[model samples]
Target: MGMSDKMVTVLRRQFEPTVEMLKNLIEVCPDDFWFDAKHKYWKQIFHATTSMKFWFRQQKDEEFIIPDFGKDVTEDLDKECSDYPTKEEMKNYVEEISSVARKFFDELTDDKLLEPCVLYEEITRTDVILMQIRHVQHHIGYCNNILNSNHLEAAKWL
Candidate 1:
């Protein structure tokens, strides 16, 4: 019923849907298709999830200032992308991140929610969280686009 609680609620709500969308995208295409650099579907998901984890760790450390990737942000996700983990690996990544997020939410105090913290050096914590949500949405949109382009369909979320 406090600000922290509300924020955590919103985050938790977004988490499951985001993971489901990623799973759907992965399921729609074969492993080879995901490795295709031309489509960049897996690349988008990889970057988004990896970046999220990086930011989450920074936040937990109360570092406030976000690390800069500089121009690397523009690199195509699929270029030299062989390091990507397997589908099972990705699922484990999601589960681990989700668990950390839940812990952060449970322990977050209302005062901390209101405290101003720098994100990415210039942005605030509030903005960082918002960006995180948007990042999830962006990847999901990419997945939808890929599915559509391939004339494939994602399973409806029940």
Candidate 2:
């Protein structure tokens, strides 16, 4: 495989299974614990998905629309919003972002991957994708910890 092709494969391996694990987490999370402020499953998933969606797109900060409950600033921190989306709503979101990620990888080119970009730091498109994947995995690990604590099966890596 070419370099771009290999990167695409790596991205799929990173993102797809993480999202699947998240889906499993949401499906099996107990109703009582779903909205628990300490480990809100929905919010965790929201943060992961939103970050993936945002960084996956090559858009400026001004062009990005922060989600309703998302915290994008120090001032926005600790401000709670009551409108967390239902699992069903977020399932659609998961699917939508899945499609977006797929398209990004599907169309990835070596030049595009190496293109210089600035977002939170000066980096290449390749670095942005890798960073975003790591961001998603961090939340995936958190969800798995919650599952383990609740006597649920942790998601396996694909």
Candidate 3:
């Protein structure tokens, strides 16, 4: 195995724990809060998944099509969703993103990983992946905050 493979393996490992945490958040979210437009709780997870699709595909904004599950769903946190996705839908979408991300990583090379990211010229592809992982965790924190505020137990760190 090469360094690219190793990096991908490490990256893949990081995903499992975060995804577990995410799914737990989905499970624990109250049904009423799930569709709550005020907090946009469900939309937070929706945004995270859609973002993975965009970054993993390395597509330009114009080129990125919102997935079927997220039709007309924009990334505005303050705005309510036109198509409010369910927890099952969001879970499935997260799994889909995970599968595709593995493919993207498999196809990556050490050289390509070090190349400039398509969207951010300042950063490399590897940097984008790391940042996006952190971004996922960041949204988890947002959702967790909601849970904590409501006196609902947050998902355990897996």
Candidate 4:
């Protein structure tokens, strides 16, 4: 397989399903337990999706548009948060950003992978995708902790 093919395989086989797993995890959480100031379940999703979409878009240009979460990221600090979306809306957000991610994979080229990108430290385009995977999984586990402690079933990848 070529470099591009390897990149696509890794994303399709790994990152994509992990995203689906995150979606499944959110779907299974009881509505009552879905939100909490301390838990930040919804906030995590926003951050994850925003970061994924933002960084992926960054690969093309510096002018990246943040996802419309109906509120700015700064609002997350507010004690009385507003403009939060329903779980259904969040699911839709995931689907939308996931499409962007899929497109990134589809357009993957060996040269693109070698392109310079930065996420905390200097990295390549391929490493940016890897960084996104880690970031999403980190938050997924954060949500999982809440679910597991609450006696809710954690999502299993199919």
How big is the RMSD of model 1? 5.4
Tens digits of per-residue lDDT for model 2 on 97-146? Answer: 77877766776766567876446556887887787778778877888788
Which structure is stronger by lDDT: 1 or 2? 2
Residue 130 C-alpha lDDT in model 1 = 64
Judging by lDDT against the true structure, name the best candidate: 3
Q: List the candidate numbers ranked by lDDT, top first.
A: 3, 4, 2, 1
C-alpha positional error of residue 76 in candidate 4 after TM-score superposition, expressed in Å: 4.7
Backbone steric clashes in candidate 2, count: 0
TM-score of each: 0.70, 0.78, 0.82, 0.80
Show where candidate 4 strays beyond 4 Å: 1-4, 58-63, 67-80, 118-121
* Overall lDDT per candidate, in order of appearance: 0.59, 0.69, 0.77, 0.72
RMSD for each of the candidates: 5.4, 3.9, 2.8, 3.2
Please write out the lDDT profile of model 1 over residues 29-57, one tens digit for every residue: 67876656667766676667666665565
User: Residue 138 error for model 4, in Å?
Assistant: 0.4
The candidate with the higher lDDT, 1 or 4, is 4
Best by TM-score: 3
List model 3 lDDT by residue over 1-158, tens digit each: 36546766777688768767877888999999988778888877877877877877755563766665545555667665566777788788788877867777777776677888777788888887887789889999999999999999887887
Instruction: Locate the minimum summed-lDDT window of 10 residues in model 2.
Output: 68-77
How many clashes (backbone atoms < 3 Å, residues ≥3 apart in a chain or on different chains) does model 4 have?
Answer: 0
